[model samples]
Target: MAHVKDLWWKTVKGPDGEPTQVKTARFGKGKRWLAVWHDQYGSEKSKAFKTKDPASKHANAMETDVARGEYIDPKAGDKLFGDFAKSWFNTVTVDPASEIRYESVYRLHVGPRFDKRKVKAIRPSEIQACLKELEEAFSASLAATALLVIRGVLELAEADEAIKKNPVKSKIVRQPKWQGRDVKVWSDAQISDIIGAHPAPLLPLPVIAAGCGMRQAEIFGLALEDLDFRESVIRVNRQIKKLGENYVFALPKNDKTRTVPMPANVAIVLRQHIEESPPRDYTLPWEKTDGESHTVRLLFRWPTDDQHVRARNYSETVWKPAITAAGIIPPPAADSRGRKRYETTRREGMHQLRHWYASVQLDAMVSVVALASYLGHDPKVTLSIYGHMLPSADERSRSAIDNRFEGSGLVPDGT
Candidate 1:
């Protein structure tokens, strides 16, 4: 292909104190070059060279980029990922706690890699590499989360005509070895250890989580308004996460807002917790002090929209330590940040409660569709992940050995 030299002429004053003659190219496809600059005084400017050598360098670079078929300006993408993310957050900012989790994924994983890359040029290989890199740098769970943001961004890109197709296809989306982590769940017997034990305040949530199969945030996000003592069912509709010094409430994950059957175990404690627990504006029992506490009767995401926060602070400040104190998990100080260590405890995150609840429900052989409804899971998701978690999986698998003749018993006995 033919090429032209670049002739970049920066404006300058002549020795005679007049604006110097405009520099012209001696040997190139053209003898003229143009200056592009901001007109505002002392604003900003840049020059494009129009000479054979320097200009050829530009052409050569651009040519090489075209040959590789993978070059986009660092600043001229559909939008810088970070900038787009912030705007998106503003438009859809959940509660403070949810913001923290999203920000964590943005800062720690997604933002740095794709921030400046144009959305259109984002390749499947690049996303795969990103998922792989996160897996290497962090945990499988963290890798899954990073991909979550990437997937959302690509979907936005497709919507905006930045790309023809979303790069994050189902098969290309990576799935790390999760759903089988060796987490220690509190068994039915172990549940007794923590009831009104030392620290005293930790008892109620664990009971609720393990017994009713509610998630950690659900346990904390429960407000007085959602509880129905007469119905023996606690409505779990919203939750929260902690961000720096404040709370941000948001909707439940998996779009899950459910009503769990309250057994006498969880119900009795909840009743006692309600009376002694002060009327909180949001539900979770956030620490009022190291010793005393207050109950949040309601939680607000933006005080207007619908969303919930992480329920993380309550987990750290209340749930985990309490579980440890109950002797269900190891004592605090398990995971630390170097010499400046935070307290260690077992059952570190609220997911533990979720796991225990799943295990309990599985042990009880709760029909998966019903389980999905209770846990607010999409139809197939609960069966896919926890179907194996059921102790009856072996029995089900055994039944599968020769059940091609499966028939409806409700049909005539002759049939």
Candidate 2:
């Protein structure tokens, strides 16, 4: 039960056996009213007020909150956001690469603004302001990542009862929207030229990417056993992820291991590539750089040293030169010291091959659900990213109606 007490006065028994009010010894020394309540754990909690009415209302509200199972300890939120976030991070479980990214965003963006502030002190308006500042200071993708880290920390605070609610999740706070540009797929001629420019030993790299829609990292981790020629499907099991200076084998994105159909052209190319240069046994740590070692017969490796393919090295040396030779991007310019500087953006990266593959699948009228499975993405995610590439719905509708009415008596032949 909760109630308010008048600190200045006390009820006592009078000579006539009736209750009477009397001044206490320490009357007028402090706040006149005290609101008293017990928390869910039955621990006594209290607050002082200058007057009786406000103290009574406070006590009533606390009682109501406790009855409704919404009790929040007033002093629990005094812990700083940074301290809570650090403690919360220890209980989080994510892939190593994602863990690294979350830590970076927390250190570089989230911590600077909210670290010293108490968890309960963060308001939705302040979170909105922080998001606006982040959008102005960084790319939309990076700002979105920062928002994720902030929300994660605050959600834990709410769960721990350190805060009544998460400000970041409040309705007033708006997340930064990513203004993603339409995916520009390379033309068939451009694909042909790029594939033709690769060295004979590595010619199958772009072929597999363009045909199977595998990410660059997934391609790096491709192994001989993953290819099923009889079934004509490629089992996407793992990817090569770089953790600091070392690399490890981790499951594919979102930990989804899917099978993508292998085209006849892709299978032929793989067979020929295998005949020319067989796969070699390669070993790398699993998940973490210092984790248990795993070995597989990888199809792709550096021809010179027979080592695993590092993305940066392969991009600078192999991918860039091939694209330049194919006229997709201009040749590199030489600096004063004669070092070559290639002018290219993410648009020209091997990911373009994936865009090309998606466009091809959409043009062929493949269902978005099937394509999402093949690409190892959620159906909603695939729809968002590749929806624009789908053939015009209006045209399909027109064609369907025309075909249905043409043979029916509903309309007289083109009338």
Candidate 3:
């Protein structure tokens, strides 16, 4: 049986034996009613409520849960959010990069607010508030990622029965609208200017990216054996990725190898690049293991060294300066003490070249399915991202409407 106890006040007696009402320690500014119950394991547990009605209600529910054998000890949820999140992180399996991203998201945004909170006590309102705060503090993508990290931890807690349900579940929290860059594709003129501004070793990078739509890492990891001049195709099987201190050869983002066709110009550029300087053996660890290593004949080599190009080093040194030189982006302004600090480049990454390729495919009237296959993207993704660039369906609709009226007298043709 469950019960609620009244937190009574003591009565003070006057000298004339008249009783004067006085508040006790239990009656002042605290929960007045105590809900007491025994768990299925015969352990006494108590919770305080501000009023008798709520206390009685909770006590009865506890008894009902115990009788139905659905009772969970509330103590199981006493673990703090930070403590539980750490354990939850260990249990989940993700790529090394994703694991690092999750940790960064947690440390930067999620940890400071809710790390001290109990898992079960976190409410949907609290989660919504946190998301709103994140929106104010970070970019839309960062805020959304932080919410996902929290939801993942709570989901693990729910699976473990630490909480009845995930508080971050449902439509309570919403991702803020992207307030960053417009989804832009560079024009052919702009592409030429940027590529022309690039120096040796970095010159072929833009041509391959715009021509084949290969990702940066995939291009960096491109091997001599993977390219076929007769077939005019590039076999994209692996990409170079940094796993901690060592670099590894990992499968492409979709985990699928594909053969991308190249134009005659792209083939010519590759031929010239290879004739000028041949591919060298760049060794990296195997993707699935740390102990074993292998070497590949990489097409692009760092100017100072014979090693394969690192994306970070190349982006900061080669790509950004080239784009700025091409007048595609303004040069970084000098700061105090005559130091120049660069803000993040605006749509100047290798992905912009990929977008240009997509625009080219769309402009050529390639079907969405075929375009998706060529780009190594899902059909829906290709449509969602680049579908707007397809030749205007509105113009076709207008032509059809004009043709319908051309032969009909129901209304004056063009009217």
Candidate numbers, best lDDT first, in rank order: 2, 3, 1
- Among the numbered candidates, top lDDT falls to 2
With a 3 Å backbone cut-off (N, CA, C), the pairs that clash in candidate 3 are none
Expressed as tens digits, the lDDT of each residue in 134-231 for candidate 3 is 77776666778788889999988887778878888758777555531356877788889878988877799999999998899999999999999999
Q: What is candidate 1's lDDT per residue for 1-415, written digit by digit as tens?
A: 3255235344568888888646555434444442333212323233355444665555455445445654333223457556656656556545444456767887877988988877766788888888888777776677877776777766665565445577788476666544544555665555555444424344566677667777766665767777787888888876654547645444577555788888887777767765654444533323211222334554222212333333544455555555566665565453355432245443355566667777777777777788887788865767666666767656788787537435645434563
Highest-scoring model, TM-score? 2
C-alpha TM-scores of all predictions:
0.60, 0.87, 0.82
Tens digit of lDDT per residue, candidate 2, span 1-415? 8999888999999999999999998698888999999988898899999998999999889888898999998788988999988987898888788889889988888898899999989999988888888887776667888888888889989999988888887788876764425578889988999899888878888999999999999999999999999999999999999987789999998888999999999999999989988998889999998899989999987878889888888889989998988788999999899999899986899999998999899999999999999888888878878887788999999999988988789977754
Residue 167 lDDT (model 1): 78
Q: How many steric clashes does model 1 contain?
A: 43
Of 1 and 2, the candidate ahead on lDDT is 2
TM-score of candidate 3 on Cα atoms, chains taken together = 0.82
Question: Residue 169 of model 3: what lDDT?
Answer: 70
For model 2, give the RMSD to the true fold: 3.5
lDDT of 2 at 169: 74
Ranking of models by TM-score: 2, 3, 1
